[model samples]
Target: MTSLFVDRRGVVLELESGAIVFRENGERIGTVPIAPLSRVFLRGDVKLPAALLGKLGEQGVGVVILSGRIGRPSLLLARPHNDAVRRVAQIRLSFDEPFCLQIGKTLIERKLTRQIEWFTELRENDMQVRYELSHALRALEEHWPRIGHASSAASLRGVEGSAAARYFSGLQAVVPNSLHFSGRNRRPPRDPFNALLSLTYTLLHSEIAIALYGAGFDPYVGFYHRLAFGRESLASDLLEPLRPLADQFALALIRKKVLEKDHFSTTEAGCLLGKAGRTRYYAAYGEHSETLRKGINQEIEWLTAQVNEIMATAEDDVRSEDDFEDFG
Candidate 1:
């Protein structure tokens, strides 16, 4: 399945027969059969009716809405999979403190390792990139041994956040000099690069959430991230390790000079992707791109398997799964 992005304001999207229709200024601009859409993304001021939403839900299509200039987003997932036993196992694992720490550490370790490798590959050609990324590498390396002794998720998060600061700082250096990027800032990304990062991460987050939900794991519950009302903390936890892929894609665009400075518009709140830029960016990432989507689904399946293994190894620590009450 592929994603459909609606970036123009005053655009009306609806379902007609078995196809999705796009109308602008009271005229039809495009039509796509429902089978082609895996997800629909509405950016800025696009309009859609409840009937179309129902059709999307019936087809199990995910919907994502991005708001304001910074593009903060929320997702509407389809109905959960019918797998009560798996969800029960997922909840049981979330309450396992030691296992949570282990998984969290492993996740951070993977992220740091990938970041180091990602930069190492670029350093041979660009000494300046290597020079800058080396500092961040040292920051990550210094704490590598400590992950084995991480006592709590909160403490592990501290290490992860510190490493991220260094990683992003060095990452910002790798982008084209013409594109502005300064550290990490969100809630209103301060520059074009930050805007790209935030938007990409948002998209990835929604993707992960849907993957987890479809895989029969509770998206709201997680190993590293704590639970909160209406938050998909598990997806957020998995997102930590996967963030580099999003960063890689964003930097690639700038380095390849596919999207120029003119591709973004600066505003008081932050930067926004111009229509031309959005089109170019989506083409590289949009639906039929199974490389990323397949990777994410595999990761989710691996995570679920990891939890099952953890449960077996520590089976004595928790109550038996069979003894748990059935929701039915």
Candidate 2:
């Protein structure tokens, strides 16, 4: 795979002969074989050699230009892949009511459990308040069977939103100063840490969407999240398991004071994270994504082991110890 090269200070990217060259300050530091690289991400105000665009397409390498924030991608250069047939198939499967509901229920339950864990790790004045939050979360879990029976995407979304409201409300009380958590805004985040969290999650969501698209899954047609114009519904569907990861990142930034008020500047529109804020956020986001990737990979490994154990035990006409494990 081609590794991502980020130029904090603007650099020049040029495809020379059989190698990709990254040049800055009259120095050549990085070179990669054209065939091995998948994507080159330009995070700074760098110049791309427009003459090499045709060759980049032929080499199947993507050059993505980011504007303003390191976390946001502005322009992407790559030959688009056509997967209309797979998208149709995935969309059809997404509408399998029973399957979609079950997956949605599992996703929400996992997120809520992690949210509870995060609260327990916070420094709150009233411990009973934490207990109450836990109780509310447990209430949602206990009623999962009922929520699982939601027939439509709209109904399931209501259940998810209700659970999030309870979770975020308890979370808001724990923060030292009020974050002004009125609602979610995409343009700019309202608070410093929130902005970081939003930027990280949006990038995460887009990355996941690209992976899903590459894997031939429909980027539209979701179970819990609503269908909106130009929204990648399927990516939103898959992001549930990772929401807690983003939540934990936000908590760490606030607790460590890595993200200060000065890191954020308020505009007439909303809050905008400064350059320093973006740097801190990108580092934190990288750590969080790695952690979640390992955790989820471990979960999958355990499931695979259980599956093998089950098959072997059944072959021997006996129940294995792993058979007692309830993956769901």
Candidate 3:
């Protein structure tokens, strides 16, 4: 299935001839067959009418609108996953302290392991940077136990934050100096590199949300991320392991010179890629995203099985405990 991305400004989408057509100044511009599309990304100033939206909804195609060019997306999904029992189990298990913390530890450790592997495999020629990355690799391995032992979500998040600072610091050593990226920043990322990171992570968030929805899970509810207004916390939870993928693309774009400083513009809002740069970025990002798609689906499928298994095991342990108490 195809994923449609409409990044052009001032384009209106409408339904015509069983296809989604783009219009500009009341003139036909382009069209795509709606039948093959599984997802749509509307970025920056594009309009989508109700009829077109309705058709997408009917076809079970997810829509993600990138409003204001950053942060989380406005995702349009079909009705909720059909598994009420699993949904209830997920909600209950989220509140299960032992279970949630255990799962959180696994997620954080997986991410840190990926970070270590990345630095180890980096083909940097700078001896100094390589030495620092080697040190960071050891530091990330040390943090794994700290994450596993975290007693609360707040504590777990704190560990994750420290790991990010450590990870990006090592990353800063490899990227071009012109980007001036020191560490991770979001909610109006101050520099071009951080802005690119934010954009890519948001895109990852949208994809994971759609995948979770397709896998019969509620994207809004999560085990690790605290419930918040309008936040798809479960998607954030899943995105932890794959953040390095976004980092990989951002570094490739800068280090490989696919994008340069001239391709970006800064405004009062923040740094952002220009139209042409964004087009190139979308093409590059699309390919990278395709490679990650297989992993995303596999991870979600595995998480679904893990959730069911853990809940069942927890229930069995409780029953055994009650039996022992009754016998005593």
Candidate 4:
């Protein structure tokens, strides 16, 4: 299944015979079969009947509404997985300090490895950027062994943050000079490159959160990222390995000039992508969504297996203890 992105202003959506009909000014514009859609992203002034939302929920289609200047998202999810056992196991694992640390180490290791791989790829391809990419690669390589040595989540996060700084520095060198990208900055990203990164990361996070919810995992209870109010920590954890991919997508957009300086405007709220830029951005993103989703699903499957293995081990240990007590 694919995702449907509706960004047009003043468009009305209706459910007509198992298809989503798009109308503007009372004239039919387009229609899409709901059967082929896994999710729908609605942005700006799009209108849709309440009945259509009901139909979407009934069909197990997730809805993501992007609002405000920066397009903060609000998720209207379908019915989550019926199995609560996996959620219970996840909660149990979250409290297991040793398990959490191991998971954190694994996540950081994977992330740093991917970042190093990307820099290595760039270093091999472009001689002009070699100096910068080599430096970043060395920094990431230094952090790789540290992930296994990290004693706590706090230390692991520190290693990850340092690696990310180096990665972004390498990225800054590769992007066009006109883009004016320095290092990574967010929460109202100050630069066009940062804006694109923030937007792409948000979409990636949303995709992972939806996948986690569908697979019966608690998105908020993460092993690596500490619990925070309103944060999908598990999704944050799962997205770590894939962040380089998102970063690459943003870089590609800037480097290829699919997104340019003219596509952005700055206000007191900081740099923001205009509607025209977003239209092009979404189109480009659609081309990559399938691959992104497939990667996310693979991660989710890995996490599910890990949780099940941990739960099974715990149960076996309990049974062994009970047998020992009875024998005594």
Q: What is the clash count for each candidate, in the order shown?
A: 1, 1, 0, 0
Which has the greatest TM-score?
4
Expressed as tens digits, the lDDT of each residue in 172-284 for candidate 3 is 88877888888877778878898888888888888889888877888888888868998988898888988887788788888778888888888888888788888888778
Candidate scoring better on lDDT of 1 and 4? 4
Per-residue lDDT of 20-110 in model 1, one digit per residue for the tens? Answer: 8999999999998888787888887788888888888788888888786656678888767887878898898788898788889888898
Candidate 1: stretches off by over 4 Å:
287-289, 310-328
**Who wins the lDDT comparison?**
4
> For model 4, which pairs clash?
none
In order, candidate lDDTs are 0.81, 0.62, 0.82, 0.88
Write out the backbone clash pairs for model 1: 2-287
Runs of candidate 4 exceeding 4 Å displacement: 318-328
Clashing pairs in 3: none
Positional deviation of residue 255's Cα in model 3 after best superposition, in angstroms: 2.4
TM-score to true structure, per model: 0.87, 0.70, 0.89, 0.96
Clashing pairs in 2: 2-37
The number of clashing residue pairs in model 3 is: 0
